[model samples]
Target: MALSVLAEENILLNQQLATKEEAIRLAGQILVDNRYVEADYIEKMLEREAMTSTFMGNLVAIPHGTDDAKKDVKESGISIIQVPDGVDFGDGNIVKLIIGIAGKGGGHLDILSNIAITVSDIENVENIVAATSAKSILSFFERVN
Candidate 1:
């Protein structure tokens, strides 16, 4: 599933993130509210992130998990959040985008790999951040795929 497909217009927005913890919590709530994952799933993912940095280089962060909370999802989903103020990811860099994913069916590697490809392309990330509408982001993914 395409990331933008699961990203609803209301879910995608510009936020003023003051801290990394807050960002993760807010994003996690969005996931649960959307029925993408369980309520506690985001907290667990944060614990996992604490073990290792999700901040991939260039102002991007992909927080993901492949646990039971996401075991029933038929398709992957992505929530794009832009923090104008940026959040510290314990790496001295402020995060501009938070791409959260819940991989169902135990295909965590495949989901992460796909995201890696997308985020690796600086141009694509740039396009996504530049997008003002969810449909525009979806269209961007279409072009990339």
Candidate 2:
């Protein structure tokens, strides 16, 4: 059976994250808490970030485990954290949305593509950022599926 990639419990809204790492950890923790990934996957996420910034344009960042971290994935899952105040990702990039994902069997690519398409429209990003509840934020991702 396929696990739910994005769940309501995995969506956090109006987070006041202080740093990029904090934001990533918060997202990762949500994944872990939801049993989507093992705790070790969070470290892999950090390692991936060290290799390259996950920050996409239009105030978004998608943090995921590295190729080697695939073993840590229990199932395909995703976590969304909304930092309405914005967090600095480096080089003047401010991210208002942080997406954490753990895909089973190369499923990450599909999830990434869906998110890229959904958030490509700046309006959607704004709507997601301004979402007052986790359910509202989840609706955005649900539509992409």
Candidate 3:
């Protein structure tokens, strides 16, 4: 089975987004491009963002759709975009990594859990941001996450 977190095609490194919305939009695009979810999934994510910021501590944000968005998912998948420069996530929060997820059959919880645990360590997040290549980041996830 394909791993839901940071799949080879889903991981984007050293990207820059002008705003949280652009980052979220790009994340949704990654999901759709990978055939993990439908295009409408982007709308669902935007709506969810309007309700609350997904920004987690350690400069991470896990943007996901509301429960209703589940139906739009064709497969459980995740996208990781590294913006080392960081984007403002409101309330003076700037997120360096944006993890956008589209989960089917409740598999997203596992994906999210792994990320939450991994990023809980400040050094881990820093190392990931500084990773020179996508392979290195994936290797790190395989080893520690």
User: How many residue pairs clash in all the candidates, one count each?
Assistant: 0, 0, 0
Query: In model 2, what lDDT does residue 93 have?
Result: 98
The models' CA-based lDDT, in order, is: 0.69, 0.88, 0.87
Candidate 3 RMSD to the real structure: 1.7
Residues 37-61 of candidate 2 have per-residue lDDT tens digits of 9999999999999999999999999
Output the lDDT of residue 69, model 3.
95
**Against the true structure, candidate 2 has what lDDT?**
0.88
lDDT of candidate 1 over 1-145, digit per residue (tens): 4644355542466788887777777776666777777777877768868778778876788776535456545455566687745789885977777877776665556767766787787777776777777677666665666
Q: What lDDT score is found at residue 60 in candidate 1? A: 85
Q: Order the candidates by lDDT, highest first — what do you get?
A: 2, 3, 1
Q: Which ten residues in a row have the lowest lDDT in candidate 1?
A: 1-10
lDDT of 3: 0.87
- The CA lDDT at 112 in model 2 is 79
How many residue pairs of model 1 clash at the backbone?
A: 0
Best by lDDT: 2
